[model samples]
Target: MQRFPFRFAPAYRLPALLFGVTPGTARVEVDDTELRARFGPWSLRTPLTNVASVERTGGFQFLKTAGPAHLSFADHGVTFATNGDDAVCVCFHEPVRVLDPTGRLRHPGATFTVADPPALLAALEDLEER
Candidate 1:
């Protein structure tokens, strides 16, 4: 199996109970061409061979990329991976925070809030342009 050269922490703050130390990185793949186009070039930067699975719950969607790890994000609510494998789920409440097992800040806080997907997408697009 191929390995990624860089490490990745949750770009957004996931609930403490969901995240843990030893965060893993997965190669981003373009399984859905339409979705990739919608997401734009930023999606290309992701490793294309590592995507494991993608799922949606009440208001959130969990993306389980390669490396058998998971990532959580919120759209209308809180969406994240429930297990270490490729299983995503949505929740009604926001996650606690993205911290290691010891509770340390991993990635920076998200600029856009989960409640607003359009704004968040716009902000993400803006960030990509920068």
Candidate 2:
């Protein structure tokens, strides 16, 4: 698997915690057939074909409007972060269950932020084209 890592500044610690996200570090992993996100102690993985759309968004603004899907650190499919830098929002063809630290399905979908918006967006676009 290939991984792209990002560390949030932890500026939104309180808000992140409110959304159940610890807000520190995160990574996006992609392979021939699937894509996954690992945030703090939570993770979400699904088939590459499951992705319906990928778009850039205001890191903090998006988080404010994004709804919380679980109590294990994800809001509106996004993994929380301290700042909105390099944020990429993803939509899936269907809900992909999110697993909290305990490995329980607390939410679904794969919306989150990465360190590099352009790189992540490009990768997703490539996947969609394929």
Candidate 3:
């Protein structure tokens, strides 16, 4: 499968670093069967088949954080995001594991910032058609 790649928008760096996130090192790659995201030391991959939903979002708003960029974890759902604004949230059919910057495993779904979200979505849709 060919790798469809996209960089994250530039605006997320400072906020991400402020919350202890690696910041400014975000990228995504979509292949025929899975979607992968990387931000500094953190990485996540989910089989396309396991994805239950995907949505474009304005990202976290008014949500105070002890650490806005902390690794995300959820037993039933996971959301991996780079910045607190402008993100793509993915939900999976079953609990999935993700690797954080510390290489620890966490479950559920993941989110990431994309430079061109619509293009990513279009790529996913194309993959679904295959």
The model with the greater lDDT, 1 or 3, is: 3
Error of 3 at 126 (Å): 2.8
Question: Could you tell me the TM-score of candidate 3?
Answer: 0.63
> What is the lDDT for 107 in model 3?
55
Clashing pairs in 3: 78-109, 80-110, 80-111
RMSD of each: 15.2, 5.0, 4.4
lDDT of 3: 0.56
lDDT of 1: 0.25
> How high is the CA lDDT of each candidate model?
0.25, 0.62, 0.56
Q: Lowest lDDT 10-mer window, candidate 2?
A: 65-74
Q: What is the TM-score of each candidate against the true structure?
A: 0.22, 0.68, 0.63
* TM-score, predicted candidate 2 vs. hidden true structure: 0.68
lDDT of 1 at 68: 23
Candidate 2, lDDT over the whole model: 0.62
| Best model number under lDDT | 2
List, residue by residue over 1-130, the lDDT tens digit for candidate 2.
7777754555555555565545344578888898877665556788999888888876366355332433324444544344656567777887666644454443444555556778888888899897
Name the regions of candidate 2 deviating beyond 4 angstroms: 10-25, 59-76, 99-109
